[model samples]
Target: MIIEIIGIFFLLLLSAFFSSSETAITRISDVKIYQWGESKNRKYIKAKELMNSRERVIGILLLGNNIVNILASALATSILIGLFGDKGIIYATLIMTTLIFIFSEVLPKTYAIRESEKLILYASPFIKIFIFILSPINFLVQNLVSSILNITNKETKNNDWKQNLRGAILLANNKGDVRKPDRIMLESILDLHEVKVSEIMTHRKNIEGINISENIDLIIDLALKSRFTRLPLWKDNADNIIGTLHVKDLLRARNTNTNLLINDIMQKPQFISENTSLSEQLNNFKKDTVQMAFVIDEYGDLQGLISLEDILEEIVGEIFDEFDKQIAGPEILSDKSVVVDGAMTIRDLNRSMDWKLPDEEASTIAGLVIDIAQKLPSINETIKIDKFHFTVLERQRTRITKINIKLIVID
Candidate 1:
């Protein structure tokens, strides 16, 4: 009886070892580990080439072998039962399951996850050897899987290795190894790849700039009062921004009674379209050594401007300087509508007040009215949008400019 029990114990131990081995292999195979570090790019390239082709096979084998080990445990219990009757079978089965569950599932998986990178590095040579030895079985399994995938429509030409890498990142995030801010920054950086320059630029109306014809005294006052260090100097209107002036230069010229022409103070301004990416913009800023770029439309009209600070703000949220002033929210009228600044961005308005404005030409409240009305509106000239009504409260230079707005129905 003692000998029989010992044999059963040995079989259980073997099964557990195989099970744990399967788990460890499954956990490590899909994980990527660069050979040495980033400095060893050549080694990483070789290691990657060696490991890429066999990952799916490794995963399949790990799952298949784990099942085999689990069944081995059950088979050993059955043999113990046959030889030693009900009580021995019960005891053997309980002991085998407990040992396998703890040693095979929990402990090994924990360690595999913790030392996954190191294990992948150290185990690469062995993994390659195993891949070669199991090539025949791997091919057979691959063919079977391919046939099954064909029936289920799951086969892929590309292997989607990139998604697997992202999944690993997601796994780390799910496991609480990555922090929220880090994840957000990663996502924001990725988003920069898809987003173009046009979406985030300031509009022409929002661009408060000085004309080049302005006097030095006015220019100095404007420079002194300005929040931005670099300001665009236009020829006649905002559309013809010839150059950008540095506030420091304006300060330097303060003692000189001599007239400072825009030409004299102007530095070459870089022009960028709305369609540029944030990443590309950063590169431009580095190359140009300038902090701001004028955003122009295809028609050469000044659309708005974007700054290094603006892009940085998008990444890290709003930044305020000593010159920055807090913007107040729109005044809510007694009639339930609100008086909103025409300069307020639609994005900001919608986010702040829970209003869904139409997403057409205008990003601002004033722009929206002009687009929809097709001309500047007169006082009491109302436009109904959904349940809300807009009444033109002010007009500045042929623009609806500002309005008294409210939602009257469907409250």
Candidate 2:
């Protein structure tokens, strides 16, 4: 009878350890639960239920205390030889404690920590039973906790969804689920609204398009020799741009000789303001069935050209295709100042140079210089605005008028 009682005590202690181990392991966040109520997202629900019904859960835990109590009492009644059995009882107690420590406390908890998801799944039914069995205790606990909370003036705080979402993003980032460029691109896409069209458009001076009245042969000659597949066709100068013509359109034209006029092959160009957002313009492009748009100033002067590819480059960095012939990014000159390609987007320049160029109407460094100078900036000409100065470096029909920009130091 004595040996049997000591063994029962050991079993009860083991059960308690197993139960606690399972609960602790399952609560760790690294084990993701797919439902809305699982993980950090459902922390509030778990917190609320626990806080509100504290007494019930505590009572249930206390009920489990029978394991410890029955085990201790069994040792007292058995191995304990009535009055003089204190030493025997102590021996029995130590044996039971050691067994519980190894089997119930250490092993189960270790398994739980390592296999939390599996443990949680297995424990779910048991947890539900406990919740039901302890419902009355839960109600009492809830009222008591509410009353105490009222006294303390504590209100429940919900789960941090943004924090959780960030955690998920971080996890993906850590596991190589997304590459650095791809992540940056995703973020850049999200920041599209913060970007204006001027940052990504080709500057006006560098724009090469044939006039609508120009001979069809010249247009065809330029189109054929030219690297670009699409060319803006204007009525006069760029300011009067009528539409755009695709190389394919030229190929498909009924009359393909020098006598062919631009109006004969031109398709309408999408017109958008310099301040339009990239994401919005992308949608506009899709809706309008056009790949490119003419960016215009408030006065309707042609500022530059913006393409779907250009906007996409903002997010994904450089994209080189068969039609991509223009050099982009900045080239720091022999001097401290830089010589950026005219085709480089203002957004890229601003990010690279940390320049505070006004974002209102222009998209290229050249356009910004032109806007500020109000005329083509000449070599050795120094223009100062606030802390910055601009000196013209080089200029051409297709080249960026290289400029040396210096920031003045304030004493």
Candidate 3:
């Protein structure tokens, strides 16, 4: 009886060890394991190998854990039966259930989760050996499970790479391993593929350009006074962008010849579709070595202008220069109303003011108002959208210039 009881205790401890090891190893992030593995850490290498075939690892652990647990319970029942007869069976079941639940499942799992990295390093070698020894059983069990799932038409979800990466970044941030700005930048870069050029580009009306028909002296003066390094040169109107004139080119022209024409100094402007993804546009900017590109609609009308700086700002937040005018995001009026530039992007406004104004159908404040109103709104015309009211304060021709927004107070 003593020997049988000792054997049962040994089996139960083995079951608990396997249970804890499984949880610890699987919980360690693959990225961290791979990093350690690359440095030739034997424990991390073994852990990585085990995780490489996760189905096999999990199958082996489950098989071994169950075998030991069942053997321990059987031995306990037999030992107790000899001592107390029929009543021993009932006592054995109750005692084994409580012991297994507390020691094997809850206590070990809690400890493993708290010290996952350290526990994984210690347990991986033993787990790997167990996996190798149980290869045949693991393979059979995995195949059976796969077949069962297939027959039931239940497919396992593949890991989402972006979501995993995002989770890892957020974890790092929460742990204070990554600073807030770095975390935001990393997340913003991930968003580049989803965002469009038109969503962030400076609208056509806001673009600073010189008319090609203007005098060379006036063009030079405009270029010198302008904060932008590159200015668009348009023919007839702002929409007909001919080329981009660099301030450096103008300076070179001034040194070489007093009679500098806009055509002589302007570089051919690169044009991109307004709907182009920011990621693709960024690649194009690098490949072409172009800083600025004219954004056009499907019908070839100028929609806006996008630059390398603009794409970069999407990742690194706004970049401002000494000469760059500081356009305030949104201004608060005396009557508790907020005044915003019509060109302000809906995304920016929502982020700055903590408003839930929709940006799906329109990109800018003006576009959203015009889209909802179904026509150009006259100055001082108030329109209610959701919980907010917007009044057009100023208009440049057909375009909205400034808007006053007020949130409806719920009494």
Candidate 4:
């Protein structure tokens, strides 16, 4: 009986180890492990290898876990049966259940959750050795699991590591491990490839450009007075972009070489399709030659301007400098009504105020209003869409320039 009891206790320790390691490994971050690998963080280097064969790692864990748990239960039952005869089955079951539940399952897993990174680092080398030794069994078990999934019409592969990463971030946020701004940035990074340049670009109407035909003094003044570091230079028409002039170059030309022509100082405009994804645009910007691109429609008509800063703003939210008075969002009045610039993107507004204004129909609040009304809204024209009310506070002949919006609860 004493020997059996000692064996049971030792098996319980093994069971606890397996249970905790299984939970920790599943929750560990592959990104963190690889980052540590880059710095030669020896403490977690083995975890990198374990993560390489995640499916196999899990198989070995379950195999070891089940073996230990069953041995412990069997040992407990035999010891109790020898002492209590026929009724020992119930007694053994209750005792083992309490002991296993408290010590082997919940308690260990709770510690694993709180210290997953540290635990995985320490345990990964041993886990890798176990996986290597039990490779044949792990392979067989994996094949059996796959066969069972197939038989039950279950999906074998999710393939969306991005969604899994997002879930991990969200889980961490809920646990207060990640702050809101950090969560936003992480989620935005995942959204970059899906978002298009047109959605975040400055509208052509709001773009400030100078005519290349303007006199040197006037051009220099415009460049200096302007808040933008880079300004588009056009020929006869605003749509006919000639090049982009940098304020630094203009100043350099003024001080050092006043003899330089506009053509000599300015860089050729980088034009991009309005439909180009932000990810592709960002890659384009990585080349040192281009800082901004003239966004054009399929017909080659100017639609807007997209800069590297614009793409970054999508990920990090609006970035402000001394020149940017209000980078994004609406002005909230004391009455709880918001006064918005018509050019404000629906996506930005939604994120700013936590509003559910749909961006699918139109990118901007003005475009949304026009789409909802089926006509160009006049000044002071009020339109109701869902629970929100939109009043066109100002308009030009061609576009809605400003709006006053309010949300009404219908109860």
Candidate 5:
């Protein structure tokens, strides 16, 4: 009776070990396992192998756990039956079930989930040995399981890489491993493929350029006055952008001879469509060894300009240098009202103020107004959209310069 009781206890403990090991191994991340593998850690390498053949490991664990649990219950019943006769079976069932549920299932699993890394490291060797011993049974079980899944037409969907990456970033943030700004940056990088150059480009209206007709002295003066390193050189008008002139090239020319024409130093402008994805454009920038590109419409009309810095800013937030002018975003006038520049992109305003001003119809706040109003709004003309009021503060002919936005309360 003593030996039988000891054997029952051993089986129960083994059942708990299998249960906890299964839970811990499943919780360990593949990235951490891979890192350990790179360092040639034997336990992690074994863990990785088990993880790779997860179905087999899971099969072995379930088979071993169930077998031990059943044997423990049977042994306990036999011992109780010998002591208490017919009533011993009932007592044995009740006691064994309670013990297994609490000690074998809940307690071990809870600990395993809490300290998954350490549990995986310690449990891996035992798991590998069990896998080797149970290989034949595990293989048959896996085949049967696969056959059943195929018959039921149940297929497991692979996780989307983008969604996985985004989830990982959010998880890191929640764990306090990654700060909010860094999390946002990481998310932005994942979204680069979805973003387009037109969404972040400096609109043609805001572009500062030098006309090729201008003399070297005037061009030098324009370059000195402007904060930009690369300036577009147009032939007759801003619409006819011929090439991009770098300030460094201009300065180099001035040092050699004062009679340098814009054409002499201007590099050919690389033009990209408005619909080009930021990720693709970034690759193009690296492949072509160009820092700036002219964004164009379908008809080959110049829409705006996009630089490498603009694409990078999408991921790393704003990049400001000594030459960058402090262009402020929308100015908050009150709790409900604010003044915003006409050229301010709708996406920028929405992001800064946490507003849901739509950008699908138009890119900029001014353009959105024009798009919704179906015509150019006059100064002081107030347009109501939902609970928000848009009052044009200034207008440049068809273009809006400044506008006051008021969020109306629906009392």
Candidate 6:
């Protein structure tokens, strides 16, 4: 009877250890584990090994925990039945239930929630040993489970790798292991497949292009003077882009040979729809081994141009070359108002200003204004939307050229 009492109490401690190990193992993030692994620490290496065999580790711990708990319950029942006859059975059941629930389950898990890193590192080796000891049993159990699942013709896979990685990156960012720019770049990579080329491609009006009818000398000079490496070539109209004239190719054609024909040196233009995604365009660029592509509408009219660099810039931010000139930025006035080019994208403004101006319905600042106003705004016309105070400063025919924004503060 004395041995039984002692045995049940010891078994409860073992139950508590298993419960804490389970909680701590699950709570510790992969980011923390990798960070630890960087130190070449044996404990974390073992931790990584345990993480790899988590299914087996969990199975072994659960099996061991249940075995101890059941043994404890039996000893407790035997002791109480000997001490107080039939009613002791009822008392033993109640006492053990309360004791196990509080001391073994709730207390250990709550402590683990706070000390997960330390507890997991400490228990990792023991868990690994237990996993090794129970591998054969775990395999049999896994096969049994699979056989049962096979009856329903079901299959399961861990497709949340992206989600898990995203979470880990975010967690690292929160822990100050990752900087803001790097975090943004990391998240942007996962988002590339979802973003459309039309969202970031240079608009047709902004493209540097020349008519193929121009003199070869003039074309060569424009190619030299222009900042862009690849210039779109038009045959009759600006919208009818025929080919992309590479400045390098043009220079080579001039230096290597006397006859400098633009048509002969120009690369065939690759046309893609405005609705094409950045991921699809990137794959196309890789497959075709092309640097630039011309974006077109449903009617085949040239909408804009997108380059491989543009898609890359979507992840890493703007890429500027030697010839690239600094574009005019927002002019911040004394009254806390900013005047900016209406052609500026809402995404760029939001990023630069750290404002939450919605970019859902429109792409550009001017477009946003037009969307909210439901009309082409006249110069000096002011409108209020949410916390934004929009005042059109400049208008060029049909489009708003420049606008002023004053964010209203709420007390």
lDDT of each: 0.68, 0.67, 0.87, 0.87, 0.86, 0.85
Best by TM-score: 3
Instruction: Using lDDT as the measure, name the better of candidate 2 and candidate 4.
Output: 4
Per-residue lDDT of model 2, residues 114-137, tens digit only:
765555544544655766866676
Of 1 and 4, which scores higher on TM-score? 4
Write one digit per residue (lDDT tens) for candidate 1, span 173-231.
78999865555455455556555566667767777788878776788789778887888
- For candidate 3, the per-residue lDDT at 116 reads 83
Per-residue lDDT over 1-411 for candidate 6, one digit per residue giving the tens place of the 0 to 100 score: 777788999999989999999888778776676687776788877787777766667777888788889999988888888889998889889999999999999999999999998898898877777777777877888788778988987857544767888888888989999986787788778878877788888899989899999988999889899988889999878988888988998888899988768888889999999889888999999999998999888998888989999889888877777877544567889998999898887766775666788877787899999999999988899978779899999998998989999988888
Better of 1 and 2 by TM-score: 1
**Candidate 4 residue-wise lDDT at 203:** 83
Which ranking of candidates, highest TM-score first? 3, 5, 4, 6, 1, 2
Segments in model 6 whose C-alpha atoms lie over 4 Å from true places: 28-158, 321-340, 353-357, 379-394, 404-411
**Lowest lDDT block of 10, candidate 1:** 30-39
lDDT for each residue of candidate 5 in 1-411, tens digit (9 for 90 to 100): 889988988998999999998898778766776687776767767767767766678789999999999999999999999999999999999999999999999999999999988887788788888888888987898899989988998957564868867889889989999987787788788878888899889889989998889877888999989988899999878989989999999899889986676787899999999999999999999999999999999999989999999999888877889877655678887575889988777766775675789878687888888888888888999888766899999987777889899999877
**Would you estimate the TM-scores of all the predictions?**
0.63, 0.53, 0.84, 0.78, 0.81, 0.72
How many backbone overlaps does candidate 4 show? Answer: 0
lDDT of 3 by residue, 18-66 (tens): 8887787678776776687686767667767766776677778889999
In model 5, the runs with Cα more than 4 Å from the true position are: 77-90, 148-154, 321-411
Clashing pairs in 1: 197-274, 197-275, 197-276, 198-274, 337-406
Over 4 Å off in model 4, which ranges?
36-47, 79-85, 121-136, 150-190, 206-236, 245-266, 286-288, 312-328, 333-337, 377-398, 401-411
